[model samples]
Target: MVNGDDNNARITNGNLAEVGQFPYQAGLNVSFGNSSTTWCGGTLISHRWIVTAAHCLDGAESVHVYLGATNISDVTEPGQRHFIVDQSGIIVHANWTKSTVTNDISLIKLPRLIAYSQTIRAAILPRLVNGSYSLYEQQTAYASGWGRDSDSSDSVSPVLRYVAMPVMPHILCRMYWSGAVSEKMICMSTSSGKSTCHGDSGGPLVYRDGNSSYLIGTTSFGTSMGCEVGFPAVFTRITSYLEWIREHIPDLP
Candidate 1:
């Protein structure tokens, strides 16, 4: 993946997603004050709230959100819904540090509540274990987005894509990122030529526990060198911000 404010993170070496495959996936077309448009990914945590990376909202004048669509451009796609939000509805974390990409999470409030269907729904939040969020090192998780298909690609994918990655140990992640990897972040093991490339920022890292899938992480950043360079991709650990999230969106489901 690329920088948080850069529209480069994407699902490199991933598979095309089917309709209703990622009901919680949200495609964002963020427009800046200068009229430049950038792409980003988001997760629907509730009918009225969308969770994404704070950097995605940097200088964002407006956000065009597309839900329930495999092809973001297909407005007539079955169950597709669209909504527009401005800065008034956006909320960036107070502690978000753009320099280090720390606490790179944010929430977007929809103008109106959306009805849930088979193709549109909220993602499940993770449950705490022993008063702390559970960590799942070595476990597999899925990341979906409409970001770039490759590091060299300038355009993001029109259709949704996803990849399966394994969770790596925090210590191992720290070894790669050094002190840059904080306890508030989660890392996914990377393979050669396989990663979340540019345009994948703010997407969900979902883990399946039993029959339920929980949102574990939000795409933050990958190595500046490139997404497929074997360094673990860092994410804003969703579990680490459960309290913060609940405080903002008290009715989270």
Candidate 2:
């Protein structure tokens, strides 16, 4: 599986994103040195770093990152920039556990600094309240990726797609997922068949606070049942790893 069947990824029942709509979005092609390639999404947090899911780098070797392009296949897209990175640049969280899906965040270093443009920019990370996240339940957040459009699809979407989903209370999500839910995770659920599926792992879940958008979550996992089954889509809470992120990307703005 590209994004792995074990970990949920992608956007189902989403709208095709316009060029430049999500300037911080990044499409990743991961190669495992055996001609095996998988896809994942990421967010540009700074000119030299991208934040993504640790699972996305599991058993991976190299990554080809595409920035500022909705269409991954189009190399000629005006604002798009491509960079190839080896495993040396991939940084998975020290406590990341694949079995429990805990601490599922990672940071990738760009080989060189990138210039920001209208179609290429970094996202704002949330400001912690007393060293922790403030509840934003009931607020609408947007998830964007180039993952599969449906559960049955074997390939990833050709264009970037996004869906608007409302954040669910942690208590409610815990009730649904039982012990699988953790404080380091955030969740969103919808009844309209809008959710992440395979190939969207490591993608961004953005929350707009006032006039600025915050990179609140990174695509983690969803129910094993399916994407549209009224289950909550889980993400690695960015707010919970601020200090970890700062430790890695010291120049983070």
Candidate 3:
């Protein structure tokens, strides 16, 4: 969903994102009950693999990834390109629990290798030494998705959305959620009124360093109250699970 006020923050809001701006962004289309569809955001880590949140996979069926997509729900819209590709496996962390939402990271395996392009490519993963990410206080990052623009209506944006995420101290962030925030997670929000909402789960929280953009975390969960209230959004830190990820996808780097 779009995170900020469109009237003032239109330039940085998710609703106006250009096509292929984020080459690694992945859009998920899953079967719901009979005909309904649910979408979740993720990032391509390799031609055959995706990294996302564990919660988004619960009860998912007929899953597909809209690769190289910017306008996910648009078919006739020009200047946009996408491919609804088949997915074979949905892998969740063994330690993931719905109750605590810990170990919320997960992976998706595609049956065939994807064709890379400017609009479709794998994401960069950081090399964490000794389990600590080198993020500093107040560091700003980027997150993209096609989640809701507002909870007023349960709708996902047709175009990809994004926001600048300012890293908040875990200790400071804990105050917003009654200490439910964990070390395995990172908390972020934008003073410009940007925050990740529904449908954004499993999306990548990116940090741009020089010419490279690294997938630093995966969207996990947020306050139960709702998404538009500026509550600190939580993410599963990738640095903590670098070993596990490497074990599963040996050639991820």
Candidate 4:
């Protein structure tokens, strides 16, 4: 009730994300009655910037980026595990459309710079990657969030969870989604049955290159069959939005 939406859910067939393992993970919370609730996930791309799904920002009220927590439920407890702050600026993609979901990404700016620590860090952008491995088809990538653990369940998990899924060809993904799999998107899934659900929206789809993690996509949407199904879940491709990202985060390297 304190961290996640009771009506929607997150990662399915995934394991818990240990403390500090995903320092860039964040929860996008909004006022719900007398309390706040996290309904979506996001990635900290810089000290003062976070990237999330455009749909998560549109039409939402009193929204804030909740970060520094591996387990968001701890916020509800007497002790603190996360930090919540109002966004200083928000940039929803100019091309974003609710009907087609063409540009389903947004940039959120914080008022102050976040101090770096084990549980809080910035993500590497795909353009800045100079690593041994660049993302490619069939390569494994990871997604982490605290959405529901089951597709049919309405309860959202309080613990951070993650799934390692393989990136697939857009053509292969088009087989499942038809016209919905746009060039601005990338698809990920596995025969092992790992995927994301509703509450996982706006979370980063990360690729590991050596010790650093690069953000390649942002959670967008999935099939109607739900998260547990082998259906390829589509994400907003980060690489395609580099120019837009730099337009907002001008100092980004």
For candidate 3, the lDDT comes to 0.73
The per-candidate count of clashes, in order, stands at 9, 4, 5, 3
- Cα RMSD (Å) between model 2 and the true structure? 2.2
How do the residues 1-253 of candidate 3 rate in per-residue lDDT, one tens digit apiece? 2122210111123446776678898888766446667678888888888888877775555567777877877665443334443334777788888777789887888877877877787788986657656864588888888887665645778888888868888889888778877887887874554777777888888888786888888887775555666777778888888899889999876
Model 1's alpha-carbon lDDT is 0.86
User: Could you report the Cα RMSD, in angstroms, for every candidate shown?
Assistant: 1.7, 2.2, 4.9, 4.6
Worst 10 residues of 2 by lDDT: 1-10
- Residue-level lDDT tens digits of model 4 in 1-253: 0122211336887898777888899887754444645588899998888899887776454565677777776765322234444433767788888767679898887767878788888889985447433445788899988788886667668888999979988888877876667777998974566788768889989988799898999988876656666778788899889889998788986
Worst 10 residues of 1 by lDDT: 1-10
Stronger candidate by lDDT (3 vs 4)? 4
* Arranged by lDDT, best first: 2, 1, 4, 3
| Clash pairs, model 2 backbone | 9-197, 9-198, 10-197, 10-200
Q: Name the candidate, 1 or 2, with the larger lDDT value.
A: 2
In angstroms, the error of model 4 at 203 is 0.1
Q: Per-residue CA lDDT of candidate 2, range 21-101, in tens?
A: 999999899999788988899999999899999998877799999999988878898899999999999998888888888
Maximum-lDDT candidate: 2
Model 2: residues with Cα > 4 Å off, grouped in runs: 1-4, 129-132
TM-score of every candidate relative to the true structure: 0.95, 0.95, 0.86, 0.87
Where does model 4 exceed 4 Å of error? 1-9, 31-38, 76-88, 128-135
